[model samples]
Target chain A: MGAHSLLPFTQDRDTAGFFEAAAEGRLVFKACLDCGHALHPPTDHCPRCGGWNTAWKDAKGTGRLHTWTTVMHQIHPDFPAPYTLVVVELDETPEVRLMGRLQGEPELREGMPMEVWFEPLGEGGPVLPQWKPVEA
Target chain B: MTATVIDDELAFAGRDKAAVVGIGQTAFSRDSGRSVLSLATEASLKAIADAGLTVDDIDGIVRCEQDNVRPYSLAAAIGAKNLHYWADTGPGGVAPCMMMGLAMGAVMTGQAKAVLAFRSLNGRSEMRLGGTGRHDAIEVVGGFGSYDEFYLPYGLQSAGQTFALMARRHMLEYGTTAEQLGAVAMACREHANQTPHAQMNGRPMSMDDYLASRMISTPLRMFDFCLESDGACAVVITSAERAKDLAKPPVLIRAVAGGAPQDHRPGMMFPVVSREDMTELGGRQAGAELWRRAGVGPEEMDLAQIYDCFTISVILQLEAYGFCGKGEGGPFAASGALRKGGQLPINTGGGHMSEGYVHGMNHIVQAVRQLRGEADMQIPDAELCMCTGGPLPIGSSVVFRKAA
Candidate 1:
């Protein structure tokens, strides 16, 4: 039997691109040629300027762990229960922020030190970068 | 004060006319055992039914939907004809206000006669529950997909953690306490105790219980958070002229507004005041605009259904809407002023905290019910009501009043 996620949710196919890159350990963003704001979840137009002049740019993945949650429930049908979800601030560019989960339980807190780890998938997918506790 | 929105006093006045007329909702639970589409249809149908109409009676549709719930499909399922007026609002909880805007536009320009607005989620199945660092990656949508990927390689994993940092920063800067956040939770529960459909029905919480609840992140305890519930909710909007014919009295949409400030260049724009950045001020401006357009004061509202996705959002909303000055939100919330029959009876239907989370549409439904004097814990002569998605960069709000 499949385990359940504590907090479950579903994204449309339109939002598949962002997840695709994160699995490969690449931080990709949508850059608008108009007002020049990097878009998230990959949109056709710049939400800031309403212009569709957009393209992709991958960031150097480095940012602070802004906030996070250890969901006691599953957000989707695919995951197991009570996983950690985090939103990280990318240091390479202020415009890009991403949310996912911590690799495994390893002591959590607010303003606690954190860093990224690109774990290679055993099932032949690209390497996946996840958040984990960082030592000082 | 960084742009036209900041200086626009016309948008900050306290009186406006957009009042809620009709309300509808489905039972909420951790497992509703229904597909997202089914739940959404049920809620939409109920709302239309409650408003004394058929699906065909509505000329427009608006929804805040995810993958399982599609806008066009919802329109088709609900049998809405000529659904030329439809909108898919996001960042969560703005679906109704977005629909309100669409309905208003239709009424103003003579494009549509009435509108139906809805929001839905199925956390039990056909859904991914939360955004956490545990997932290797997330699908990208309009904005979250494009720019949000930049931070994935780092440790930043979810919205809760992001807000946790905001909470810590606030605590560090202003001596805010976890108990203060607990007080907010208690206040929400105090209102929840009276509602029947609330998930935590009859569950009483104290500041100690809140502090003792499992810690999701420091400063954000288990009780400080809102539960993930599977459910759907809907609301109907019609011109005041047409509303007189409905089953429930018309609650006019006095004024409605929403915004996302431009400044939080990299993050979700937490620590709204600490950052003092230009972009993080949209919510405050939106609140100011609502008050200005509606022509009423915050104290004048009979009840409020402020979204409680988390206790922190409620605190921010209090500041954003001027329920209290910045930094005073903690104490203001602790005062139990939002309890039922208190200064501003909020979320009498338990809100997202005590009630199952149906995104934020349930707040709108409850607001309409309160205005109709039909709430499970009704406020006496509640002629006016206010509801919001609360603290989203792209969030929405509306005020309602009993019909003349």
Candidate 2:
């Protein structure tokens, strides 16, 4: 499937902010308003407190590289082979982690600094979060 | 959270109550050219016959939820006179050992006399589990809830990618190398070379072959993946008293435990970015109960038929199930302790890596063979064997013992 076609289900209320922020070139993650715990992939209720009070906040877009893998062979047409996929711990909430692709070839080391950037799926299409190493 | 330990008295309630009296399987192949119902019927009838019982003796049936062949269809084909109980268990490869637990539950409750638990699939032909399709494309995608919407867009489409991510973390933390992972693949291929029924039987693998193989995902070579095969396997379970009069020696179902992690996320291939430790899995959650119920720890297991969907999976499971300390699996596996006459003979029938992947049904069958003293790489005096489903965060396990 094409990258543009793989957009999130817009009907889901929890992810409404994620798509809006992505369109504006900003990444967002959910945090429970009641317990101050960060959540991922957008959920309605707090996993920790079981409270429905939750809010979306702009992510700090900086974290440390945890681990990653490069798709040596292409499975999806939209994603070419040999692209790096990464797992990063968010700077705002180290307990919360996010998965995305690396934007460019950069030296990878455990706990190295990383920051999120946007990669458009196509011209005027939905953008995706891509992480890269912070300049030394 | 503290691990829940089952007391000795409660553990005996289901311990040695039911026995796997028969096991039958069709030839594993890329294409069977037969309907799934036909495959299920063939395996079911063979298991019934192998147990020296008739279809009328089978009062119940159990299968995986993903199985194309329905329980009622197999019951009808086998001319089961009275189908008292039947159930379809969950997710994917994690159901084989759990199906035994369900079957045993049926027998213990007098819901059925003899229960046939089977897994049949045309994985390569009908359902290319690896085929391209949107997760939300289906109206009701069984157990794979809405979690697919999270990771599928990021090209985390297959189990290989997710496993590679966790394996990379292990490497970073423990300094595990690709060479350690290769040892698992090499060891299974060695077992497959001697296994007459194994598809990869004639083609043995070496460390050189493993190193030269193309990488599918980083650190996960093509050799790490299991073959997509079409086949069916069935095991017949009856009361221990009834199994005493059966055709083959009964392999007693000593213990069974399966549960989700505390997070209880839908595991297989969903985005696990939220997990604190990627290497953590419910295998240990179930493992603790399995050992308690079986009244034996890892050291007492004469052989282990751990799930080997990928080489990394085997390494992780060895550690999760307490066969070795955490971060010690790479060295433990590379030490050749998992081979024949080694510390723990694992996957004697080649495992899913080299054996045809009947999803873990083959593992259970191999465990029965080892306990029966009939395996190709039979370990001497294998009285107890451990078989696991997939080692994902949500998994299942069972302990089988030779009938005294």
Candidate 3:
């Protein structure tokens, strides 16, 4: 499948805000208003303190590379070969992590500093978060 | 001043309460040219016959939630009368042991007399699992409102890619090598060579072949992945008492445990990245409870059918299940401990790698075969066998002991 044929995001009650914020060039996650606990892929309630008060919060858009993989085989027609996928532990919440594509061919090492950027899908499609190596 | 609270007594009521009386499976192939329901029915009937029971004797049926064939459809096809219990378990490869656990619950509660557990799919011909095909597209990404929103857009879609990240990290931390991973593939292929019904039967694989295999994802070559075959496997579970009168020697279900760790995130199957330790599988927690309830340690196991969706999964599970210390799995595997004459013979039936990926149903079937002295790659006088489901969160493990 091509970039245009990418699976459409189902914006429901829980995920509408995350995608909305991504469209605005800001990476967002859920944080408990009660106990200030961070949640990824956001939940309605705080798992830590059992609090119902949770709201969307913008992240610092910077993180340390926790792990990575380079795809050499083509699974999708749109996504060509030899692209690296990375998981970055957010600077704001070390426990919370986000996954995105790494832009360039950089010699990757664990704990390498990285920053997030947004890329638009083909012509009015959803905006996606991507990553690049940032100097320590 | 401190207060202490004591928990309730540890009464494992399900311990040795149920037994696997029969096992059956269809041929492992790339294309069955038949419907999945047909495959399931064939396997279910064969298992029932193997148990010396007819379809009329079955009172319960359990299957994986991902299965295309439903219990009602299966019951109708088998002509089962008055089904008392029916349930489905799982996200994927973790369902088999969980299904057995549920069957044990049903029999213990007097809800069902005999329970049938089966998995059937046209994984290769119709719905290939190796790539981002229709099956994964609908179930994982589109159908379920999962956390795929984060990774799917970035083209991080397949399980191979997801697991490659774990394998790479494991190498960096423990100095694990591609050769060690190849050992796992070679061992399973060796076992499959002995198994007549294995998909890779008559086709041997060597370390050189494994190393030379094309890379699908870095640190993981084609040989590291499991096969995408079309097949079905089924087993019959009944009370220990009823098993005494069965056609075959019973392989008692000593114990079973299934769950994830505290840090397991929701929709974590795809993005297992957020866990406190990325290299650890759910086997650590589940294996602990399994040994506790079975009253047996890992050392007592004559053989193990560790889940092998990929070679890295086997390495991680060896550690998580306490076969070796943390970060020692690579060395342990490299030591030839997974081979037939080695320390703990694993995947004696070739497993998902060279056998066929019937999810994990084949693992349980192979475990029973080993205990019953019927396995093609039988461990001599095998007494106790351990079978693990997938290495992902919400995983499960089961211990089977030959009747004393």
lDDT over C-alpha atoms for residue B262 of model 3? 53
Runs in model 2 deviating more than 4 A are: A1-4, A103-107, A119-127, B1-11, B131-144, B262-268
Ranking by DockQ: 3, 2, 1
**For residues A41-94, what per-residue lDDT tens digits would candidate 1 score against the true structure?**
456667578787887677665566655555453434444445566656666554
lDDT (CA) per prediction = 0.65, 0.83, 0.87
Q: Which is better, 2 or 3, measured by DockQ?
A: 3
In the range B238-319, model 3's lDDT, one tens digit per residue, is 9999999999999999999875865777774775788767898788889888888888999999999999999999999999
Q: Candidate 1, residues B270-352: lDDT per residue as tens digits?
A: 32322333113456766776777777868888888887877877777777777877777777777777786577777788887
> How large a fraction of the reference contact set does each model reproduce?
0.11, 0.47, 0.50
Pairs of residues clashing in candidate 3: none
Sort the candidates on lDDT, descending order. 3, 2, 1
| TM-score versus the correct structure, for each prediction | 0.74, 0.93, 0.95
Span of ten consecutive residues with least summed lDDT in model 3 chain B: B134-143
- Chain A TM-scores in order: 0.64, 0.84, 0.89
lDDT by residue for model 2 (B154-185), tens? 76767888888988988988999989999989
Worst 10 residues of 2 chain B by lDDT: B135-144
